[model samples]
Target: MTIAPQRVVTLHYVLNDEQGAVLDDSRARSAPLEYLHGHDNIMAGLERALEGRQEGAELTVTLAPGDAYGLRNEALVQEVSRAAFPMADLTPGMRFQTPGDDGPQIVTILDVHGETVRIDTNHPLAGRTLHYRLEVLSVREANRAELVKGHPLSADVAASQVEDRKVP
Candidate 1:
């Protein structure tokens, strides 16, 4: 099957920065990434580039920051009182996940002062361009469970969903 909406695709990718620095490589791990197409499991630009592609297809794509992790927003930087995280030594580069209205928001510590700690809520890759070398390993129609979950469902979970279903 071709890589299209509702299809599960397995692909190896080598991610690099604008300067050609290797950022992430799935090939080194010997495990290709598998995801349901059209889901937000990956950057939009990369997914769009693979639509309608077939197995063994290889391509390299460059993505602007906006199409990738997005531009960094200075407004996301804020200073909070030290009392918020009592007994813990907050240091730079430390990340904290706080429950937000929608989901957990990851905020990274940038600086620590006596009574206040400064944090940046932008993604670590924000404001950086993304370069990707991708090769499609395989593509197949996603199972009903995977399509419903917006991701790959484990075999156990798929079995449970099957048992819970009541056909009319």
Candidate 2:
């Protein structure tokens, strides 16, 4: 059946940057991700792509910077004094969370000078297009347990429920 709103779905995905650098992949010795559809669990573009797809389907989609993260803004880059950061050793490429207009935002260290630290508030993937390779492993009717939990029921749990409901 095609993926529909309010349905629980499970899938594996690989995400890459414009340069083909692997950002995140569900196939890296980890379990497939599960989430309730239309709940903002994944990227907007990805959610749109899975709207009408069924199980065991594979799709590759490319998303622009605006659709993925958003274009980088130079104004988001700020240089502050090293004293602002409590860490004794501040290094470039290190990321830290700080307050922003909307909420908490991650800032990456761009450069570390004698007593000054330059940081960028933009997302690391900002201003770059995103590429995703996804595979829908399974899509079945969500049972009562899944509905109650607001997510997909685990395989073991689903099996146990089936066995419990069997006639003697």
* Candidate 2 C-alpha lDDT tens digits along 1-168: 778877878899999988999999998959888877776667788889998999999999999998888899999899999999998988889998888888789999999999999999999889999999999987666777666666777779988978988999
Where does model 2 exceed 4 Å of error? 140-168
Tell me the lDDT of model 2 at 168. Answer: 100
Candidate 1 has what TM-score? 0.88
Backbone N/Cα/C clashes per model: 0, 0
TM-score of each: 0.88, 0.78
Best by lDDT: 1
lDDT of 1: 0.89
What is candidate 1's lDDT per residue for 12-59, written digit by digit as tens?
A: 999999899999999899888988889887888999999989999999
Query: What is the C-alpha local distance difference test score of each model?
Result: 0.89, 0.86
